[model samples]
Target: MHPGIIFFLVILGSVLFHIFTPWYWTDIASNWGGMDDTITLTFWIGGGVFIAVCLFMIYCVLKFSYKKDRKVEYKPEDKKLEKILTWATTIGVAALLAPGLIIWNQYVSVPKNALEIDVMAWQWGWQYRLPGEDGKLGTTQVININDDNPFGINLDDPYGQDDVLIQSDLINLETNQPVKILLRSVDVLHNWYVPQFRAKMDAVPGIVTYYWFEPNKIGEYEVLCAEYCGIGHYAMRGGVEVQSSIDYKKWLSEQETFKELIAKQQKIEFGNKKIVKNNNFLLNKEIYKEE
Candidate 1:
């Protein structure tokens, strides 16, 4: 019946609505990532403080509120009170931030042996490249795209010799593997989003960004584009099937041998090209303008 109670009820209802809202992207808040525990701890501490303050205000309203026929009294703000509040707030902040900072440091410093994988996003599809037998990913660009060079890897670079290019349905397997994702986009911006893993990063054109995660559980997870780029943004979805170590090994071997066959065939075809077509070079100045 009171105005204050009515106002409180309205605010409570709004908060409940937000909590129970069905709209959600990834389970980043509820699920734990590399530094998720620290985040959750900070959230709980903040929630506790909010609840304590609200309860104290409620007590003041009910206990010291206006009463009829009572003499009004007012007191000046206390310096000791302000000092106590300041120290309490400082300690609370330190308690909340210290563990979070420590965990963040660990997250940033990944193990040296952790496998690195490259993810290139384009107009509508995603391309994944692995550092084949070697532990290095070669640089790539879109200008060199062709059937022979699917991932546009720098062939002149010696480090690219053992690099693995997986552009199609090659990552499906049966085991869990730790992988670090280095993201790049050829066109507009996109997001490498995997909800179950709680991992995501922006795929910006011209610049490279990345995130790493080891899927402990095995299942088929859908990767969604968190940022809308074009009309096909809603349809920008892919599948990642995490498999066991044995199945993953088997899959990797098959991919390697298959790629080897293709590479050999391409080399042979290029070498067999005769000089018969070399004399037909036309001197068309207008048609051959440089782009």
Candidate 2:
């Protein structure tokens, strides 16, 4: 079989496989359908280049194959060809990059009314903080962190008092509402990724990163750590549930505030100390009676 013929067959098979493939992008559940469009445009441009190069190779294989009577030309370079190639490459790269830049601009520009949520990541878990009725997230720092204040929210900041803390793996959002997620990391690097949202960002230590998305559908979406931080990285999973505004509010209402959590911890420690004191008093009385 001729090499040119084999290459032609390869191209045909590639196209046929692509058209008949069962794979496709996941359903767009957020307002970022533009992201999908941008990706598809990139695929078309890259696939076209691939097919063109393959066809050109096949053409050269058939047309320029060594022949007993033919002599090869020794042309060094073509100025016109070089200019055409340069412009083609520039246009191709621009076409691929322009949409991404536009989308990125919109991604970083949070709407004024978008709800703010803080996502804090650790080695094997996720924690969340949502602004209370104040509608403003308070200041936080790594220095203020402890087992009680896992989110590192400043205890001195009055604004942090009412901040709802969710230590569980599930986060709930209102459907059709824009949400700006502020990402943070307490221990190591991690990524908050939800495939349906088409948005993800890094959670760097001592820094806050963010992205926004509006869930257009009501469903449960799986969240995974996209970065390889450690051996337990694979188990660092979470979830997001998009629900109606009423349900979202109800869920939020049930979450504990930062102030409440601190008070609860204090009460537990006090009770433990009281029990120990009573036990010591009883032991001293028994010793005195024995003497």
Top candidate when judged by lDDT against the true structure = 2
Summarize candidate 1's per-residue lDDT along 211-270 as a digit string, tens digits. Answer: 666676666778788988799888777888777788777777666522473579788887
Q: Please give the CA lDDT of all the candidate structures.
A: 0.70, 0.92
The candidate that achieves the highest TM-score relative to the unseen native structure: 2
Among all windows of 10 consecutive residues in model 1, the one with the lowest summed lDDT is: 274-283
Model 2, CA-based lDDT: 0.92
What is the Cα-based TM-score of model 2?
0.97
At residue 79, give the lDDT of candidate 2: 100
Model 2 lDDT at residue 30: 99
Q: Model 1, 158: alpha-carbon shift in Å?
A: 2.7
